[model samples]
Target: MAGPQETESTQITTEAPAKPATPEPKKKAARSRRAKAEATQPAVSKRSRQSPKAAEAPAPATRAPRKTYSEKERAHKLSQIEKTIVGGATIKNAVGQAGISEQTYYQWKKAAAPASESDDLKDLLALEEENKRLKKMLAEHLRKENAELKNKLGLA
Candidate 1:
């Protein structure tokens, strides 16, 4: 039994008790309310909602060339790649200038490693060259000393 102020919608008559209005949960009520509100407005399709370029077909992805070269040309290209990379340039730019892929450039560098020469062999060769130069210098110094000693000893 509701007061006269209550409308027909809220009136509780003596007739079979009307089902009590189920209280909606806060989250679901808010979401359904929003959906109902949006239903009144016109909706744009996904594609039409995008920029004008959306209608145009995308350009095909470009692939880098896979070119082969003579051994001499390959050497030249490797030098170009190494120079650019060691000079603080990007590997992509260096490889581009060398007309090779980054993979090829690394392959060339790895292959350039001297298989016959170990670290010990390399050190020995360097030391041998240094020893040879020092020996020549020592010979000259000894010759000058010998000449001075002969003159001093009256054997000149």
Candidate 2:
């Protein structure tokens, strides 16, 4: 028979009492395997020494550092390869001209090829143009949408 306001006030005051604080148990220190092994093993004196070479083995010599091509160099190399293709030169000739191995030339050529066996240059150029066009369209659309959003939010 209580009114709505009275019921609400009673519900608000009838929440569970606060929980009692509990004491935290202390943590035990951890012992490492290496520490246990050292403790179990017999100790050696500082005067007991081994030969320097026997104490530590020398590391094997590392291979020479690889050569990295600059962006200009890479572009020039690709251009030469493309020119060789346009000139109808053999892979050997192209490799010679580009100062790269035959394997490297073939690898680059294979990587550059499209799904079809047609000219890769045409495909690459078409892709580049398409990418440029798409980017331009996307930028314009984003600009318009951003302006609209700003106006809606009373930021303009």
Candidate 3:
């Protein structure tokens, strides 16, 4: 019984794993079909010449050049839009009548603001920087004073 069991286990261990047979046949069949198809079909060049009808078709109409507004034109348009708005027309309607988009109108308005406003902003930014510098200086001075006091009190 022991001899038979050992022989059975050795046979099982020595046997090779069986591979699936269906996939290899399918791949070979596909390759043969593709080979037959390619042989029957004529090869085509990528850049074939256009047909007479396509060549004779008139070229598409060229687009008109885009109109660029100068500063004077932009300011005039912005003012016209504002006047219409002041006369109780909706901003959208005013901007449309002025031949400009609302976003463009806002951009022009922002750009046309008084220089004094920007000057004030610059001054405010300068003051904020000074404040930060002063704060840092004060903090460092306090830290040094604290250390000195600690030394005098024998806490360090």
Ranking by lDDT: 3, 1, 2
Off by over 4 Å in 3: 1-64, 114-156
TM-score of 1: 0.40
User: How does model 3 fare in lDDT?
Assistant: 0.81
Worst 10 residues of 3 by lDDT: 19-28
Candidate 3 backbone collisions, by pair: none
For residues 63-154, write the lDDT of model 1, one tens digit per residue.
75666777778778888887888999999998987776788888876776563357669899999999999999999999999999999999
Provide TM-scores for the models.
0.40, 0.28, 0.34
Show where candidate 2 strays beyond 4 Å. 1-66, 109-156
Local lDDT at 56 for model 3 = 73
Off by over 4 Å in 1: 1-67, 115-130, 133-144, 147-156
Clashing pairs in 1: none
For each candidate in turn, give its C-alpha RMSD to the true structure in angstroms: 13.5, 33.8, 26.4
Model 2 agreement with the true structure over 47-155: per-residue lDDT tens digits: 4335565347553455666767664675578778778878998767877888877776566556545523466767888999999999999999999999999999999
Best by lDDT: 3
* RMSD from true fold, candidate 3: 26.4
lDDT of each: 0.77, 0.74, 0.81
Clashes of each: 0, 0, 0
Best by TM-score: 1
